[model samples]
Target: MKSLQKLATIALAIILMGSCTAQEEATTLKDALKDYFYIGTALNVPQVAGQDPQAIEIVKTHFNSVVAENCMKMMYLQPEEGVFFWDEADAFIEFAEANDMQVIGHTLVWHSQAPRWMFVDENGDQVSRERLIERMKTHVQTVVERYKGRVHGWDVVNETILDDGSWRQSPWVRIIGPEFVQMAFEFAHEIDPDVELYYNDYSVSRPEKRDGIYNMVKDLIDNGVKIDAVGLQGHLSMDFPTVEMKEEALQKLASLGVKVMVTEMDITVLPWPSRRHSAEVSLNYEISDEYNPYPNGLSEESYTALMDKYVDFFEMFMRNKDIISRVTVWGVDDNQSWRNNWPIRGRTDYPLLFDRDYQPKSAVTRIIELANAKKQ
Candidate 1:
């Protein structure tokens, strides 16, 4: 009887050891793909300050890189002309340094979230090209110079091109003409030559926008601009941006001889407000059941579909990993995702790898498995 009890205890210990080994092997996204490329998510004020314990742990465990979701933007950093707010931005850098994680400054120039003071005079008239250029230099240099060697990269200019293969006609374009993009890149490089400068935009998988980005980057390089990378905001939606389209787009972006990064990626499993798949914040639709079909939660079938979509996208990222330097999800999980009220308000959308409960969904394991399988 004593010998039988000992055998049972030893068998139970062996099973426990096997489970521990498996858990250790594939615990987090950062660990799973540490050898491939950097994986990251955007960090908000709460997460940066350790106000949200769950989010802090999630970020520490699953990601090796982070981008400021909003605090580093022009509006947040410098609400006034010369008054730069460094509290939140400084805290972000401190947190990143403490954790040994890389940080990416969201943007130095963008049409959206740009302070109106920089574009207009006290009399409410638009600033001249020279005036606007000076302002741009001041903002870009102050921000970039402050964080020199601390950040991995900066999205120098964002969303300069439109979906129709034309310029977006932003104030920068109206005031400084098309040269603002190059100027932003140059100003950043002037401050920190070692930092990577990226021109980030969304809807890159659409043929028109993709071609526009390609043409623009090609022009910049031809003109001897110091641009380093192209960041495609991978705000993917279900049934849009087919894998074939992404492959072609990735190859085209890489052909420019600049590294490619899938920045701000998130897969929206919800139905679109319109047929248009865009990240434009101005676009909004009235709330309706048709648009918010999954208010309760995602169906089993839909969840599986979402998982499959994630696997497909990760496979593509891995396929182009040589040219791809980093792949960052836009948010940590469903609850924190901006998709909650984007385009259509008051909707529950399960678009990320983790659910609302902070439990990683099926795609986490599947993605890690896919990466390991490729290695094997």
Candidate 2:
């Protein structure tokens, strides 16, 4: 059975490869990618200086959009509850607008990095469902209204779905239940009426997670909520669920009439089964122990393997560009990636197009090639 599965995976990959023959005809990687992909990256607020000029230039030369400074919803945007702060976000918004770059708002409501002041009873636990809904409505209305036309889209909610395909135990979820996702979207739509709204989550490359998103979005669509796209936060490891699963999930979501975007793509190369890692990384449910090793940083061979995986996945996406809209990297460089302490702590992780020194990685070159290749 395992052998047959391998055969089938290869067979399907071959068919996809044949269908993506444009990858072969492209003379240069950049030329090919420009035609098929929207290559963009997230920017840190502090790093947007002398570095930003060069970084934005590189992006303008190669990509189309920019995901602004983690834009952590109303809490960060309006830390004083009603008072909104756009000083940092404005720098990016204005920069992108000045450069004619598309802008994607990182998130509106999320489980993590939420302001501590959001939902607190007098005792400081959390607000009730009723209060939470009001907060959601107010936050969405205020911020979305401020940037209604300038902002291209909002990650209406981020990481509300867990790795096990269950709704996260967020304050919003604990109080508002499943309706929170719908309410978030409705409020955003009512406020902007124009900005594209998406539900963004990590590990969407997994089948269960992808299916969870599909089910939720489909339900929202059936209930008459306006959801525009799904952002697959493609934070990948060296060896994990094949892109085949990711592709299948994207196709299914597309069938639901929602656009798909590779929102936060980064491939982390970490040592396998390292004692310092947690049960999640050690268990290798998503990847075999043999495929990963300890001292979990990306090795030369692992980098190459991961790059190939990216090529295969993007080829699949290019073939389906009719539904998938953008391909965004979580960070501009490896040094900026969150993978350093995530999934594996204290271990160095190389997970972006550019290295810590801001030099382009070979993976970036190959991805460009895949993106540029014309369809056969």
Candidate 3:
């Protein structure tokens, strides 16, 4: 009886060891990032106190590439004229380089998030067209020269086209006019001939927006603009954007010889307010109002729906890998998502693959399942 008990103990130990091994080999978010396709998240220097080793751990474990700083641009890189802030970006780039991760520079020129002094004159009015172009060229050169080969690619222009295929009435258009995007790409190429340049924007799934970006890229490429790719900032919602629209957008962009990327992807559960009803229209339905609770936050069902929505998009991404190059979730987890504000205003939104505690949610599991489907 004693001998039998000893054998049973040995068998239990073996089983426990096997379980541990399986857990250790479990695919991480980083593993999913590297194995099937690119996965990424944004980093805020101030929030991380510039010692974000966890960010590196995430990339090392999951991702092959990352979109760095709004780096290589006006807002974060050169917050003040000729005053470069390399302290944070320097650490991030070095971290990525040492860890064998590729970094994509966010933007050289954009309507939003740029330093106030960039477009405005000493009088605080729009600068002249020629003056704006020179400023843009200077900003682009200073940034691209600093990071030339270290960063892999850049969003030379961002959000220049509106959802309805019209040009946004940005101060950029008022000052630099239509030449802003073209000159931005030109300046990037001048600095680093090898680094790819792309035009990036949100709402690529909308037919009008997709067609508009396609036309814009076609013209830029035709005009010798060295534009190598287009970034589809896939900030999706619970249900509106049909996957058919997304697939069509990819094929259309691919047809133009430009690579497409699902940049800034986060599907918010907060019910996307119906375009049919104006913003002034108060939420009458209980489901819509609770999902988009004005003062407090998202309901529990809204949070679950958000995760399921992300899974659906990843499933679509799996099916359409040929045209998609990089897939970046804007933030790492729920607490960090932009959906907390902006649209929903004062809502506790859960939008990414990880929950607020940094635990991988079912969204992460579904992503892995979709990515590993072929192996199964």
Candidate 4:
């Protein structure tokens, strides 16, 4: 009986020590990058509602900022004129406050996900410019006022510029002119002057689009519009937008005296489609096995390639830390990444720091080491 008791005591001690080591090894990304910039992730409905235990744990353990992936968009927030839904957005903000995380209102104006009623009347004809502008003001003011001080930042306008440096023919522009962008910014500022306002978009690293964004921001500042930051949606891949391209764009945007944020950062490991520049959110491809190459799982070589790509981007981010204010991963883990269903549906893509099991990937350790080294 004495020998048995001794063995049990030793086993318990070993288990405790192993647990401690694992916890220690799980260095939180937020802490690692605390000196540099905010580490953030987008929260899907499951995460925002506290339904996914594993994802919520990862968010609390690793991130300091959060954005709603869809809940705060115009369609969901204001499905009809003068009818605003606050259940999901309210819960999201509450969750952020409870966790002591910074919250970003994803967008006030975008071509997609906005209700068609705003652009058309009961007769299905385009609303007059005066009517459209008034509706825009009301929507922006109401949304921004509701979360004035609670939300730290707002993407007032999203994906407004095209690859050719021209304004995308969004309904807002079609009816109210490009000044709609400026109006949205002004309204947001009027409600919450302290909150940061950002112009968010993808494909910002392309030279033409980058130039367009720079000019637009410069114009806004020149006209006394309060634009605080530029959010470059970092939905990148392993190959395109080389480090030099990204750095050049960052430097140029920073030169305008506005902070830059790498929002929605993720790397799709799957093969690119032919129409890569199409900014259509609803675009999809027919299911094909060729596109889903790693259906079984990523091989050692593929995984290494993904890690290397992330490290390269992190190194670039560290080098440009002065201008970058925040680096937000698109989702908490690979299982929740939008890439799995984008361009091609039903394809498995690993594009984030955490794996499907909620374990930190090797890149997480490498990034922590990089951050720590920078601090030293």
Model 3 over residues 57-170: C-alpha lDDT tens digits? 554565667765344456888788778788777766776787677788887888777898887789988778888788888888988888878988888888888778878778
Which one wins by TM-score: 2 or 3? 3
TM-score order of candidates, top first: 1, 4, 3, 2
Pairs clashing within candidate 1: none
| Whole-model Cα lDDT of every candidate shown, in order | 0.88, 0.74, 0.73, 0.90
* Tens digit of per-residue lDDT, candidate 4, span 229-304: 9999888887877888888999999999999999999888888776565435777888688889998779899899
Model 4 TM-score, 2 decimals: 0.92
Model 1 Cα lDDT, one tens digit per residue, 248-276: 88889998898988889888888886767
- TM-score, candidate 2, is 0.82
**Total clashes in model 1, counting residue pairs 3 or more apart in sequence or in different chains:** 0
Off by over 4 Å in 3: 1-26, 33-35, 47-59, 69-73, 273-304
Which stretch of 10 consecutive residues in model 1 shows the poorest summed lDDT? 19-28
The TM-score between candidate 3 and the true structure equals 0.83
lDDT of 2 by residue, 207-321 (tens): 6777787888989999999999988877766566467877877888889988988887777666555532222322323444453353445567777786777677777778877
Winning candidate number (TM-score)? 1
Q: Could you say which candidate leads in lDDT?
A: 4
